[model samples]
Target: MTPSYGVRERTAPAYGARWSRERVETAALRVLRWLTVAFFLVVTLVPFYYMVLLSFRSIQALLLAPGRLWPSLGELTASTYVDVLRSMDEGGQGFLLFMRNSAVLAVLTVIATLLVSIPGAYAVSRLRFSGRRQVHFLFLAVYLFPSIVLAIPLFVLLSLLGLRGSIYPLVVVYISQTVPVSIYMLRNYFETVPRSVEEAAAVDGASRLGVVWRVSIPLAMPAITATALYVFMIAWNEFLFALLFLTEDPANWTVSLGLARLSGSIEIPATVLMAGSVILTLPIVVLFFLAERMLTEGLTSGAEKG
Candidate 1:
């Protein structure tokens, strides 16, 4: 039989075209992924590196060499840290008080948020009630609203109540702002837990509260830890609420507000402010890394089954 060129030629060209296209797409995607990684690494690290470098150099050195990336050994000093951390009466910026205030507020907020959210989340996930759907909607609404908008009304209310500048009111605000999201996070994890386990505990003569205390809480410990860390970071890094509430009272200033105030003064050196920024950022970085694994597990614990 004579060789048929039509079928063989057409089929060969189509196969070749598909193979070439796939190879081209694969190579392009590989290159793009590396580029994206490099871009993010540079974006995230360069500013932090610059901040540390500037923090160690003298104001005079930075003024002399504004574009320099590295400071000479002779130009490096730790006085900026000392100056930023000491009390105002001691001829420094008084960041020690700022750190204390920030810590107290963050801790209190975390505690209060967890206290309210754990039970609230448990109820939402496990109970049947008339307003259950409405409650979920309300939480979603609050979470979607801009905090600044709510801050205005809260500021007015606090002022009327004579609690405007107090850290106590800020704690209340943080709890209200964070609790909705906290409940949402915890509720999802609660739903993932098997109800039979709770039933088994009940069969063993466990009271409702006892079952929740021993069974639900223990099962959701990872999510709770993650939630607490999240709440702490939010409260620690809060600037808008802190400024709105505490700006008039210098003694109540958190680290975020303190660093901002420092930047507004002509007398304060940039290097000293950079040092303050570093101090403010370090605790958050440490806490995040410490809880990172638990947070990851908590968030992904139920994903496979879902």
Candidate 2:
């Protein structure tokens, strides 16, 4: 009997071949994943780096050496930031006021959006209301509607009311834009929460409002944080309504509108505008990181499936 290429030898080759194929595929997948991650990081981070790099250099230096990626230590200056933050009366651009205005609008928008969205989301998620199904469709339609088209009507109305150049209108616009999405995100998370927990609370004679306040809100903390941060980012980065409403009043301009307006001017340096871009982008990034941490910690708590 030939022992060659029989049962024992064939089994060894088969095992080796399958193992080799699996190892090769796993290695390829890992490489692909890492490559995709690297690509994302570079795409996201390079523009930020360029903005910071140019922000530290003078307009003269930037013009003289537009292609340079790194500035010499001596070329770096705090003058750009100083010029940006200083008052217009002091011969500076007065972005500090713009920043303050933007901050107030964003904070107010966050508060109002969450206040309205939380109860709305809770109602939609828990209670079997008459218009329950239609509510989501309405929210989706509002969310999907073109903001610019809405802006046209808003602009016309505000202009007629002589409110076009105020931050108040901008805040209201931000809230309207944010509320639909907030309700949607929060409702999804609210639905995922176990109904049994609320029923148990109800058995203890807790009212609907009491249950939401004591039970649902606490349990949905992660989703709340995420929603608030999302609203904040939208309000902070909002440009169209800001431009439409506040462009006439430079004194009341938010950082976004201010940067956009100045971006078109021949008198302002590109490096200066780049500095403004960095300033505009920094706070949202910090808030997002904080929100990400909260979301991670929230998900792992009491998430064991039965």
Candidate 3:
């Protein structure tokens, strides 16, 4: 039998209305999610793309066509990058030296921060010590302390010790800045390691440190990797401390300091400044991409089946 054009649902009117409401909500949420994603993508990529485009062309072309969003092949010039990356002796900005210094400082900070924070975190998590429960608060307190406060004392100390212009002193400062937060993050991951596993390792004649190195570290590798990446980026992009320490010594300048100089120098064209910015940005970008897999990996994935 054919149904009437207008039919009322008698079995469950409330369920029909509720179901319609839920479907509408779900569809609306899905559209909102895509719109949000597209918005962020545009906000992030457009400025970076424009900066990159400007770097590939001459300042003359850019000024002549101020509103041009894209450039023709003939208008594009690689000289901006050449000047940015070349040595000062060759009448260029010498960013390669700056990049090298930054790389050294960042790598050293990562290593030293990991070394100090791992044991500190493990002890806070596992050992019975006075104020162990409250240790995290201290870490947070240290992290919350203003950088300027720390920088003043550190700068004075380094200068007194005749350590100015050396990257090692900067490395030490970065280590202090990073280690507290690293310990804070690593502590939680360390606590998640089963005491039984550690006990078994101890029963097998492993020392406390050995168990940490052999068993706990493997389990918490994902967290360790993430913390390292975090610290690396902090050291890589840190400007205030780098500027305070290395500003007087151009040879010891980091990418951040070099970029700052480019920005402040009127003789340096905006295109050249953009090139310096891209150079400063590339290492962190590459590192993030390389560690993206490790960052997303679960700490306890292999320990249990979900």
Candidate 4:
């Protein structure tokens, strides 16, 4: 039985309608994805490019041509960098000391956070202790709380102890801020490790701590590295606690606080401040690129199993 031509044509239009809709939707989504990528790229890269551009140009050039993207060869100078990095005694901004302070605080926070979090994470992941589940809630509570709220009590405690002007108090505050997240990251990775591996180590006369240190830790090194980097970045970039604790002591100022303080000075050049910003941003960029691969692997290690 053959269908009539008119009827066949009408059915053909109906059959193609669903496919046409799907094609339209798919193409729309593809275009939307590219637009999103381009938007974020501009949002993220443009500021850093501008910062670099301004860092190379003098204040006079920038003021005269505020919209210029590139500086002429005659206008480019490294004096801004020199002024930012040299000591105040040398008539510079003394950002070199700020960088040193930031590095010390970040490194110390990473170390201290890891020391507390690693064992705590292992215990939560591997042990069957009383109130183990509730511990995570405690961590979540701490992590969810605003830092500004926590800062008040911390500031008062430090002041009472006469520790307000030292870097050590800032390190302690950062440790509190970072340890909960560190424990969470490490715990997630540690749970993915097979218990059989630790049991095997134990069969060889290794103690519980020995199993954690020698067996489990070696396996979770990637996650541990990622967590350490995360903690370091947080501590390095933190401003509020640094401001509260170290603002009274110029010698103790971290790079973030120093750059902020520089902004308020009418005598300092904007180009020099921009150079200081570049210096402050450079280490984080370098560290991220260096550890990018390890970080990726660590973050995605257990995804396939789920």
- Top candidate (lDDT): 1
Top model number, TM-score: 1
lDDT of 4 by residue, 101-132 (tens): 99999999999999999999999889998998
For model 2, residues 197-278, the per-residue Cα lDDT tens digits are: 9999999999989999999999998899888888888999988888888998899999999898888989888888788888
Q: How many backbone clashes does candidate 2 have?
A: 0
TM-score of every model? 0.90, 0.85, 0.85, 0.89
Task: Summarize candidate 3's per-residue lDDT along 1-306 as a digit string, tens digits.
Answer: 212226643344568888677557767777798899999999999998998898898888988998999779898888998999999999999998888998889989999999999899889888998887578788889999999998888889888888887788888889889998788778778878899999999999998889989999999998898889979989999999988888879999999988997698889899988988888887788888888765444333344556
Cα-based lDDT at residue 217, candidate 3: 95
Looking at model 1, the pairs that clash are: none
Q: Whole-model lDDT for model 1 versus the true structure?
A: 0.90
Candidate 1 per-residue lDDT, tens place, 1-306, comes to 212224332223558888677557767777798899999999999999999999998899999999999668998999999999999999999999999999999999999999999999999999899999999999989988898899889989988888877798899999988998788779888998899999999999999999999999999998898899989998999899998999878889999999997799999999999999999999998999999987666557658678
Go through the candidates in order and give each one's C-alpha lDDT. 0.90, 0.85, 0.85, 0.88
lDDT at 72 for candidate 2? Answer: 88
Better of 1 and 3 by lDDT: 1
The TM-score of candidate 4 is: 0.89
Winner on lDDT between 2 and 4 is: 4
Off by over 4 Å in 4: 1-14, 293-306
